[model samples]
Target: MGIPALSLSGLYSLKYGDCVRLPSGAEIGYEANVNFRNSYFIPDAVLRTVAGDIIAKEVFPIHLTEFAAFGWAWPEHGNDFMFIWTQETGVVKEVENPDLYNRLSQDLGETYFGASKDMNVNTLWIFNQLKEQGRFNSDHCNTKLLTW
Candidate 1:
């Protein structure tokens, strides 16, 4: 039997076309550019099978510009990837407690699937590519510097 894998649906934007406050009380400015729109961030995620089987789970930080640039310049025929950016300085990392991480991941997954039942294959491909690029490697702290 083939194992069912969880897929990513649309990203849920926490903020849209405005300044975002970081955990450090600092703010990241959102300048209007060719690549500006509402943005989404998945602080963590968990995957499961339809049979109520837990497949895998993970926790990490991601800031994608594509979700914000959807209508502006995204989902091109062959170009469906976006750049990931992170705060370089003056940012405090919120220590994710295990319980909170699990809860958030589960909630995010449920919310995402509840809103949209279909997954964008192209976006998933790009996300996998980013993973291969070490952008999502939890072992590497420098990966936090990911940006477009």
Candidate 2:
């Protein structure tokens, strides 16, 4: 499954059992509740490249609300989030929590995924490809410049 493009229109916080109108005009509700896990937040750089639309500075709080409502887990590792970016659709794709994924997967009796060093390198490659596609802007990228 392809990750859905960030629908700026549907970007909003949701609460437990709250109804949401998706960009597709479908009304949906959280099957569960949402909560934010700061410990799992992927760094800004990773969010900007793979799932940029959802990570604006002001959106963190909303993101937290949505995370718990949807029972999502934030992936601590960069590569794991990118893999998520490659597999889901709509705002659901922006669900970058690996911890959440593992939990849900276990509940649903699905296999869990782990990262290898090679997978990490591949995620970097995908980030570069996104840059080429104009899905990323270097200016928005979080980077450090060192002067000697």
Q: Pick the candidate with the highest TM-score.
A: 2
For model 2, how does the per-residue alpha-carbon lDDT over 1-148 read when each residue is reduced to its tens digit? Answer: 1122122112312212223222222222222121223222222222322222332111111211111212122454442221221213323323456564555433322221122212322222333333444422333222211101
Error of 2 at 6 (Å): 36
Clashing pairs in 2: 33-68, 33-69, 34-68, 34-69, 35-67, 35-68, 73-97, 73-100, 74-97, 75-97
TM-score of 1: 0.18
**Poorly placed runs, candidate 2 (over 4 Å):** 1-101, 104-121
* Minimal lDDT window, size 10, model 1: 1-10
Q: How does residue 125 of candidate 2 score in lDDT?
A: 33
Task: Give candidates' CA RMSD values in order.
Answer: 19.4, 17.0
